[model samples]
Target chain A: MISVTALTVSRGERLLFRDLSFHVASGEAVALTGANGAGKTSLLRTLAGFIRPDAGTVTFSAADPAEARAGHLHWLGHLDGLKTGRRAREELAFQARWAGADADGIAAAVDVLALEPLLDLEVRKLSAGQRRRLAFARVIAAPRPLWLLDEPFAPLDARWRAALGLMMQAHLDKGGAILAAVHDPLPVAARALDIGAGR
Target chain B: MILFRRELALAWSGGGGPLLACGFFLCLTVLIPLAAGGDPAGLRPIAGGVAWLALALSSILSLERLFERDLEDGALDLIALGPAPLELVVLAKAKAQWLAVGVPLALTAPVAAITLGLPPAQAPLVLLSALVGSLGFALTGALGAALALGSKRGGLLIAVVVLPLFIPPVVFGAGALERATNGLDPAPALAFLAAWVLFAAVVTPFAGAAAIRNAQG
Candidate 1:
């Protein structure tokens, strides 16, 4: 379970969000919604341990939802985080190896993502949508139980969107938790946590 | 090990820069004697300096790519969060850079020396000194690369940050070559180069890793 309590985040002299509290229990899917510049990405980044809040704390608890798991959260941001000048297959393999995923898991991720045909193509040569797919595949391949996805549906087509929704459902069925920031409505029964009013 | 291997593979697959740098080294080594005109003795005396300068130049050519693209794509952040410690990641990256740029230059030094009219016996010492010196170059370059990752003009920024650090290696490497070619013991210069490499190996990774972290943040 991920619990964020009395969180206050600021960039420079401006406060992006304050007094923000939320809990995503095991198997729960929570969508972060806000207008432009409403701190949705900041909230996700803070949850993923990539950003530090100006006040309060974010905790990941197995029981009380007030503890932190230093290594169990996976973050997939908007940039896609791909290494350029490398073939798609090689990049995936490298990421998997670095993440300590076994060979079988790597192969399964490639197959599920339908990345076979583009395996030998360098990442710089791949389309933006394809790069996003590759980044999504990396998240799926990670063994982390908590996922923080920022703009997860950006370049995905309708077919990929449905597939991703089903994938998230499967992940939730396995007792995993998700915190995603999306502009579009997610095709899941997730409680919306709007960050506009800093509630 | 995986990170090191991946870095190596990436450097190997990147085209143009690595090859052109090696070619430049070779061509420069050959051109020195031709330009000096009909004086084999003069060529021999300057072979060590020419070879070291060529190696340094080749290394600079490849340094710009070290962390630039990875930082842009967010791979550097992922690597920092991976299982390996940041220091080890920096070391692995330095090793890859050396393999791509330094190793090739070292391997071809003997051929370059031949063109420069350097004696066969002095060739190995020149190559060995270059290899050691280039390790330091790679480490220092990696730090500069990390520091310049997000700058507006990264290429020029890296060159500005790194050129000063190149002095110690260039001096010792060329000095070692000069001593070797002149039949004098090259131990002191070689020792200095080795010590520089050891010092760089110990300290450069931390600086590079910290720079990467700051850039990511």
Candidate 2:
């Protein structure tokens, strides 16, 4: 299970979220809904160990989030963050290698994302939707137990969104958990945690 | 080792700026002799200095790419999440930069030496000292690269930050070559270069890694 207890996140003297507590057990999908500047991404970053909370702790049962990063959690942020000048295959290979995923795992991910035709193309040249798809494909490439995605569907088209829904379902079915921040309604049945402005 | 190999691959692919810097190094080496009238005696005295300056300039040119792309594309976050400590990641990156830019420059020192009319006996020592000294340059440059990752005019910013740090290597490398030409052993100069490399190998990575984390925060 992934848990955030009594978390208080602040940015430069302003508290974004105070005493925020939450948990997503295995096979659960949790959506973070919030107004503009409601600290959704900050909350996600804190959970992913990318940002330290002003107070409280984020715990991963299997291991400390910092120590077992590859095994325990995966974070897909607002930026598609693809290496701009690299071909899709090279990017996938590099990311998979960094995540400790195997060659077979990478191949399977490419096949699942239907990126065979685009595999040889440079990422910078790909459209935004294609880039998002490629970023989404990384989740499949390295199957971590917990996923924290910021705006996973922002740049995806309807078809890709549906495909991503299925992917999320598959992940949840396999005993993985997801915490995603989204403005649009997700295809999956997810519990919504709303963060309004000044709350 | 795998991380180092990945960095090497990224640099060697030349899609980034390192390849252009190599070309710049080559061009500068050839241009200086032509501009200086090809006076072998005068050129011989300053060959190591000229080469060291060229290496430093080219290195500064390529330093921005060290962490900029990764920071922009989110690879920096992923790397921070890797099992290897961030310090190791910085070291690996510095090593890769050295291999791509420094090692190539060192290997081709003979060409620069010949162009500058350096004595044959001094060429090897100049190359060896440069190889050692460039390791320090790469490490120190990486720290500046990390600090300037998201800054405006990042390339210029790194140069501004790293040029002052280049003094020690420039002095030692040039001094070693000068001593070699005078028929005196340059053991002290070479030892100083080695010491600088060792010191950077230990500490610069921590500074770089801290800078990266701070930038991300």
Candidate 3:
């Protein structure tokens, strides 16, 4: 679904990764593993078109870069990206409209994440696990083909982690692709790529 | 459509932006009198000018957040990933901000002008100029904010970048008010002010979008 060739990413004076290449196909999940500061997030950002690469190209085999960018991927970065002052429901609705998701998508995401009771509260008041779950819901909110996740399961407890695993399995079953940076084991069977080793 | 509503809600929320700008506008009107002593003649002459300056300065306060906040929260990335052109997103945000902050500030101008001893007859022109000038301010200010997007000193940088751009509007607006108050023809100055707004409106979206796209790295 997504491919990169001869990708090199650097942060200021330090080089994070060099001459990297990888691909994730439909119905596949790639677990990007690396130690801290090993360019895991950088790779995800680069593929998601957030960071410009120092070298090489990231392309979709079936579509143009712009189409791949517009609605093909859902990125869950380090920050939850929720507005602290806005209510949870309001934030989700805003994102839904922007992401071109419909009412059913929003409701399914809210239900899967079990966010019904938390809808009225401001985002700032939500706990860490809840916050992470709220962000995770975006993947479900819009059924995008690609997901660029940075530490996808970091803040959730075991149960929520399991729920996330189930969601990933379901998404993969539906022919979606995932590129996630993980520090721990993911319940879904994934092809692991260690960024540090590639470096 | 959704982006506009969300921007408006965020701007007007508690401790958000628009109300704070109005408060700042009121403070400037109140303080100038105390600073200048109780000389009605001197105060009346400069009232329009002081209001123009305050409006320009207060406009800076909100512009800093126009893009910076979204950039920080990762929302900018999401917006960029959307189907809409980034230029339209930049323009929509500035328009929403103007509706939230500029409209309220413009509406409050006549009252603020009255408090600053601007002749009651000049209040209408003061209000008109404020409305037009704010459109210029909002557009130019968005460009400045986009330019200073990732800077550590974003607020100061935006002020420095935007304040200079504000001068033309301030000059034209104040000229319109002064001429009208003096019972002279203010038509030429008003025309210039209107032209400046249209110019800012056209230039900002393209320039601001490029600045924002460059900063994403």
Error of 2 at B22 (Å): 3.1
TM-score of 1: 0.89
Instruction: Put down candidate 3 lDDT per residue, B87-169, tens digits, no spaces.
Output: 98888988888888888899889998888888888777888889988978888899999999999999999999999999999
Candidate No. with top TM-score: 3
Model 3 per-residue lDDT tens digits across residues A1-199: 9888999899898888888988889999999999999999989988988788899999996679878888888888887668999998998887776777889999999998999999999999999899888777767888888888899888889999898999999989999999999999778999999999876
Per-candidate RMSD, Å: 3.2, 2.3, 1.6
Candidate 2 structure, TM-score to reference: 0.92
Clashing pairs in 2: A81-B73
Candidate 2, Cα interface RMSD: 1.9
Clash pairs, model 3 backbone = none
What's the TM-score of each model vs. the native?
0.89, 0.92, 0.96
Off by over 4 Å in 3: B14-16
Candidate 2 lDDT, B1-217, residue by residue in tens: 7678777877877565556777888899988988888777778778878888887787777788899888887888777776688898998999899988888777666667656777776777867887888788899899889889789899888988999989888888888887887888999989998888888888888899888877777
lDDT of 1 by residue, B55-127 (tens): 7766787787888878777777577657776788889999988888778878887778767777787777867
What candidate 1 keeps of the native contacts, as a fraction, is 0.50
DockQ, all models: 0.51, 0.52, 0.64
Worst 10 residues of 2 chain B by lDDT: B13-22
Interface RMSD values, listed in order for every candidate? 2.3, 1.9, 1.5
TM-score of 3: 0.96
